[model samples]
Target: MDKNKFIKDNFGISDKTLKLVSEAEESIKEQFKHIENICEINQLRVMKAFADNRVSDSHFVATTGYGYDDLGRDTLDRVYADIMGAEDALVRHNFISGTHTISTALFAVLRPNDILVSITGKPYDTLEEVIGIQGEAGNGSLKDFGVKYVQIDLKHDGTPDLEQIKFTLTHMNVKAITIQRSKGYGWRPTYSAKDIGALIEFVKEISPETICIVDNCYGEFVETEEPTAYGADLIAGSLIKNPGGGLAPTGGYIAGKQKYVELCAYRLTSVGIGKEAGASLGFNRQMYQGLFMAPHVVSQALKAAVLCSAVFEKLGFEVDPKPNEIRHDIIQSIKFGDPDKVTAFCQGIQKGAPVDSFVTPEPWDMPGYSSQVIMAAGAFVQGASIELSADAPIKPPYIAYMQGGLTYESAKLGIMVAADKMLRKE
Candidate 1:
């Protein structure tokens, strides 16, 4: 189907909605110009630095010793720390997923029987099982270790209730507080790193000894500032998301104060063996390039989300598009009432994946979330990629939650193609 016909048939966007989408696209294009200019300036600096031999071209290999081991990975870690404005940073390819990174951080800080206060209610579906919440049938991380867990749900406005947070801190022997930067799944609203900073301050006031940790997975590089920038004790994230810049094959990072990084390093590699060994292979280069390209790629994803929202909202679907000055990025959700429409939309999206041509929805036991049906389309070699995921609630009034596109062009194409498919059915 042609683009216009496809849009008309599937999305049913009105003329007013098209006008708004057009305006948003133009605004994004203008923003991209600024991003290009910044990239050019940074690129020139990089080239000059390269010519001057200021940066090493040889890949840094992780060794097994403290100061003597993994000089390359260590140096990269320091560089990342400086970039993220944290006291220390540890990057490792050994972490297969974001959950691994968070688990490492938790293990480093929490002792047996220590309490983990979840400031962001429940975490992503995968993390629920690890934290010993929903999937207790098998031994999980927290359950195996005997760690206590507590959660404080965000209000409908997406703000943590300071009083509730204070109450939880006061009532529990909290060892650490985990706050997710963005809504992991579903169409719930969220706070920016800055907004989260306020909650962090509140938590600290209630429990001075409690360590503050942020699950900074999908949120990396979406904002000019990060949770660490606002006094978060530890911030952990995946290399495959915003920070990966569509470059990293696989990796994760933890950044915070020097002491936390040190402790996490010990937990990550076993206390006796530090990162000086060859734990971080093929990660430094991807991290370097990913960090360099992150802002641009994120901007593209933001554009696609905004455009999709405009189109979907016009078509009479309830959509949550981040406001002009909103903090969270790379998530756009549309509420489609019919399960069949949700399934068809997901299939259309999967057809656009870089790695796979077709995907289908399935029912599974997803920990942490109450949803039944799930669907995803990833652009990576393995199915581990979140470059795009579209799932719907299996209950009545199904709403398809769609997100991804490593590049802005691909994301835009995905939305347009999905819209086209919908229009044809209409």
Candidate 2:
């Protein structure tokens, strides 16, 4: 009969769940308006960047060997820097992953005996090795490079302990302050651009010279404003995450102050080579087209996250940032007390995928984390979170973090299927 009726009949949704979905649908409509406003702003940004750079068909051509004077690559960096309100930007396929991009930024800024303070507490698990907090000897981590590391744990509610942060900044040779915009694998709130802006101001007040960096993965394009707008010295993220728009094959970006980005470029290639050296190869087309499509893709993913939160919360699962809550990032987490249910949830997501549907996912000791992790990502691009994926580290809370949906419809299907499968298991 109607759309709701069709969904209800086909998905075998319970009356209770349908009622919750009805409320969610209403809430989502209001949220859509907010996203629409953001999209408009972002659209203007993309159009302006293109117009300013005079992006042409020739700009999309691939380059090889040093990629010197690669107009497309240079313009792409300009567009990224323009959109992010940064002085400069370096977008390169050479920066392997989000972790690697962040590492390059950190290393570019911090020197031997300089103190690097993480005001957001311990960063994503993958960075521990990069920071020399973990990993084997002679890896030449930040710690190994003689840069001291310190962390100020967030309060229970995920707010940084300002007193601790101030104390840490004042007492040591705090050269840089890092604020992670995403929750990472933790069950904490993601920092909004506004939140990070305030933190930047606070740091500037404490030490005007100390540089501030934002680990910006999974948080871009979700907000109307970026951390760079509010004084962040550098913001780093993977192209495979939100910025890629499901098109970029492999890459990451670092954007912010010109001098800082210059240092990162130096670290990326060599001191003299800098940003001029990296070859775009053939990624120019995808990078250009993907960035233009990013705002729309990111909006779709955000809507999917809201839907996932609503659906799972209705099923009596603990959901982070309930569906109606203001979203700073695209991630939605559902806690399953039992690790079996966690695995089942992820498996259900994989089952619903358009790709790799026949394959099953299992929890294993994934390389970057302390706990065994199970991930369900049947993305067209490898590890692309801009498509539907559900993953979680097997731990006490056993929460599955789900993010990315290229389209609202695909994500709805995936979340509903996962809910159906998990409910059946229950």
Candidate 3:
């Protein structure tokens, strides 16, 4: 049977949808090639990190109990540190999620009187409770612990407000500041590595004592240089995102200067038992393999994001960082005005998934979010955004956030599936 017929018979993709996918791909060949170039540079960096750390069968052995003297765990930390251009690193499945890792980094460095300012305005929705900006106090939030929080909104053009940042840091006794490298739930464009580096320099020039932290969840390997290369004190993210390469079942990492990473490690375990306490359990190989594959996987995601923008923009919907733009993260947002359209698009994405394709995703009040979120992810690992997923908050200016594609081919089909359902009414 023809490939188009196969898709139509097996998945119900319309001929129009298949034609749209082809046109979108044809228009973005240059962008796809550009992603490949980035992948090549990043691949070299990962391979060198592994080889330099002497990764071998010995480093793949899993330990149990206290995990003391776990060669694999320790060596992998070194590998991650090298890749991040940081002095030290803490990588472990104990982190649970990206937000957890970020919270740990904040708690590790902040004290009762220390003021923590977010230069990127507000952070992702999940951080609202953690920062004590939302939810009840006395739950060990930053505010509950007496840590002051300040925010500087981005400019109307979506760039960082450097002038305001300088003014804020000039006189304030700021102890620490954070930069969210990814767009998160915002419609703003993601900051590139060079952009982040300049921000770090500006902040350091004004407030030399302030510790700089970056939430690097979806931005890893998107560029050759990470925030650490620009002198970030600490960078944290979830293993289920970019760095996991869609293979790590569960984990997170914080890589940066030795002092901060050591502090975070202590927080992850205990004061006396830093990185030495957590056992690799049975996940050593998967984590290592995931890092090895991350560069290529990230490229697949970038390509998908570009194609998604191309198709959505051509259809007269609003898209952030249009298809021709250089992306700093993997997420692609499409503004859908109607709630029903949001549901149909999400369900279409779910249908293209390899797992749970028969199931329809629906909106629910998921924890840690301000709004009811409808998430569609048919992934091998639950909630792994690296494997073709779309999620949206069912509200005004309802925009769907689509990301992750372990393979470009899979993501292309998923986009087509979504387009078919989304345009059915018209």
lDDT (C-alpha, whole model) for all candidates: 0.70, 0.88, 0.91
Deviation in Å, model 1, residue 13 alpha carbon: 14
Query: What local lDDT does model 3 show for residue 248?
Result: 98
lDDT of 1 by residue, 1-426 (tens): 576566556545444434555665765555455444644554444344334434476644433423355555776676667656688988877777888899889889988899998888778777877788876555747867889888888777766767788887888889999988777665577567887788788888778888999988777656666788898999998877777777877888999888888899898777866555554544667767776676666666665676677667655678775334353756777778787778777776776566665555465655446777667575673533447656666766677766656676666656655665676677
Model 2 lDDT per residue over 28-73, tens place: 7887778878877887788898898899999888888878999988
> Which residue pairs clash in candidate 1?
9-423, 10-422, 10-423, 62-277, 63-70, 63-276, 63-277, 64-276, 64-277, 387-404
What RMSD, rounded to one decimal, does every model reach? Answer: 4.4, 2.0, 1.0
Best by TM-score: 3
TM-score, candidate number 3: 0.98
Query: Candidate 2 regions off by >4 Å?
Result: 1-23
Report the number of the highest-lDDT candidate: 3
Off by over 4 Å in 3: none
TM-score of each: 0.84, 0.95, 0.98
Once fitted onto the true fold, the runs of candidate 1 whose alpha carbons sit more than 4 angstroms away are 1-54, 60-68, 137-140, 322-325, 358-372, 384-386
**lDDT of model 2 at position 392:** 94
Compute the lDDT of residue 46 as modeled in candidate 1: 36
